[model samples]
Target: MHDLLRDSPSSSPRGSPYGPGDWAELEEVARAGNFDVLRSVTYNRVWITGQSYCRNRASIDSCERHLQSLWYVYYQCARHVSHESFEQDRWVLDIIRTRGRGPLTRPAPGGGIDIARTPEGTVWNDLPFLATDMTEYWINSCAEMDSKQRINAASFLAKLASTRIANDRLCQIALDLFRDTFESERPLGSSNEADDENEDRHRTIHGLTIASLLPSACAWIREAGHNIILLSDASWNDCSHSTIGTGGFTFVQSELGQRAPGGFSPWRWLYWLKRLHQIAEEASKADEKLLAEQAANAIDIMLSDVKERNSQILRVFEGAGDAVTQDKDFMGLKRKW
Candidate 1:
């Protein structure tokens, strides 16, 4: 199989360089349930093709054909194959990590290669077969990634989060990543306007992308009976008190005051809160009792926090004397609150 794939011409008129006869033989191997051999050959072929493409030695079409072959074998024997086998494959992890490195040196002169445009990125974005493992890998890797790579990773995970295939583990990973990234103190703004603006843009992009994961994560929590205690148990110790506390209802509330320090703007905070409110309302209408109650409690806590913040602002105005109350801006602020 390796020889056949390696020796195949890139300009073949067929969709794949491998002819029908070659596929038939491969299908026969699959029918015989020789998955170990098939998997080994498939990974080897994929790695070679991916490397060739990354190095600009192979066409995108050729790389895509290799992925097609992988999907073919996976679909052919999906029932017999264990997801763990695919997840544990070193080749799979290598392919995922490759995204972090961006495309290898291209012969043509351009700026940095867009990893999202690469075939491996296509595998990360569109292939549902390995979505679970990919999502987990990216979530864990996001911490060490540069801002751009983190944004890309968050974008991929957000798409996965919207899908029905997102499981509890993915939700847990997303939550942990969110808390770890946002709860930490961010760097103080620099005097360089360009640098500060760029930093703010990255923060907004990252926050919004990560926020997209919340709906699905909340749904999973609701399905789990809103079991905050179970979620924060030793087995799931990575889930911080700020995250699983209140069954994830306090997630946005806890970060509401973190605008300047945590890099989330007030608008972004409101967006997160709005999403939680929508989820809570949906749960109530669906008669998800535990989730609705937990969500209501979270809403109450959020309101209390907002009121306290407003009170603090009012005190500041009062301390500024009667002129501050008479100021149009102060009136606007009061009405806005």
Candidate 2:
């Protein structure tokens, strides 16, 4: 329904990511009682992109926070949609309590906010990316679920699904973060990228486009009557990975990696900001010209950023020690419990 409402293609071609057969395959897996695939497909790509370190030692921790919320979303799905013997009724209440109590925004009165107090219409960072896969997998898997799972499925869908405004706001936040990063203007710890990678295994996950990483940004821009180049089919995803125990892989694909036809380069985004400030200087009451120019500049900057980042990745790989890009056959990974 979400895809249908947006008039986007509901499924990819047979060989494309999330291919036409994926839905049935997902449903079959669910029916056969292998729920791990549900979480793996939903979380793995995000875990790679949002958590893995790369060229500049940067990671999208905000994306990680978004996925954690989704972890709770999955727990909700499991309790309500899956047939696991454990009683899930209590677990559902716990999810509701955690999500509803607070901290979607401000701290609580007693020093920590409960999830229940989380604001309605508040756009959490990286939320759209988190929901994109979760919604699809949960809905498909729950089709074969029992009555409880079905009821939970409805609730899960309601919580994970969002509007264009929500999507746009989330994207705007990511762009803002990137801008702050590119300018080196962000105060230290401004992003979660500061976390020193510990003993926990680290793997670089790539092959996600800007469109895939932050769809809400695309949705948000489109609604503003501006073209978002990142959404063009040509966009690609690039990042890296390394660890002591795990062999690495590259995520590049001829199909997934494409020139963003109309998107802005990160450099262009900065240039536009400068241009806007300049226009702000000349604006006789903020004329339409300023708005129009800003919009055009923004589109250019994002697309260019993706291209330049990919180029940078290539350079980093060429100069660095033995390492891997995200180009390996990750579909073969078997998760160990």
Candidate 3:
């Protein structure tokens, strides 16, 4: 079942390079009646508390728009990550010039068709859900990209928040997840490693991850500034103290860590976090006191960015692909979002 969810453009590093052996493990998992893996494979997104849509356009309708838009925006953000992963997967495979003796399959440039473009039931199985299947695909496809491409791609995902998303909270989360993806896990049961060596490894990977996530964080905050002002002016009188934006600030600080003076590398990760803090601080200075619902809308945007980033990173780490699939029980067995 999880294997079913794993199939996507990102699932193949260079293309849909699956052979007979590729499906062997998945078939065994299926035969063992472990369909429950499906649930565990699902990604997390913050669901709106309200069940039904609000009808009143004045206050309630606005809230509905905010919530719905946030969800859609998050979906779009996920799509961006997935699209980037698919592209990177193909790019990495295309440029791969392996000289050693290996049975690695390679795809011609643009020869491998995207599942999105291929007819269903022909090249693959049923199309999986966009949110989970495709997102996981991005994660798996990360292995296909070389280190340089991975770094650049990760940074690109971080920067996504700035372009149209402009949601700082979301961007910060993306960075965090990306940072986490680069880390190698110690054997689950064993914890004996040289401290210096471990520290060096963390610093090296963390630096790259931080560098990737920060610029995007700054971009997200900068882009959202105008929206914050506009929303503030639009909801001057009716704004409640619990607006989504207010909650978003709290969420950002809590999830991404606060921006204190002289903490960690500002150029990589901490700098963007500081920028996010500054954006939130500026939002607080609006002319009118923000309504709880109104603020919540802004908060939703931020949270969604974080969620999207996290999703992308998860896809990069735990999703399918030849590179990440080297040790199924090692990297593949880990429970990622």
Best of the candidates, lDDT: 1
Query: Could you give candidate 3's per-residue lDDT for residues 219-313 as a string of tens digits?
Result: 33333433322322232212111221122223334323332211112212322333333333433453222322233343445435434444332
Using TM-score, give the best candidate's number: 1
Q: Model 2: per-residue lDDT, tens digit, 75-108?
A: 4445335323333333343334433422233334
TM-score of each: 0.30, 0.23, 0.22
Tell me the number of clashing residue pairs for each predicted model: 0, 44, 20
lDDT of 2 at 124: 34
Local error of candidate 1 at 114, Å? Answer: 5.2
Q: State each model's CA lDDT, in order.
A: 0.41, 0.31, 0.29
Residue pairs with colliding backbones in model 1 are none
Candidate 3 deviates by what RMSD? 22.9
List per-candidate RMSD values in Å.
18.2, 22.7, 22.9
Which model, 1 or 2, shows the larger lDDT? Answer: 1
For model 2, the stretches where C-alpha displacement exceeds 4 angstroms are 1-16, 51-124, 129-149, 157-337
Residue 311 of model 1, lDDT score: 36
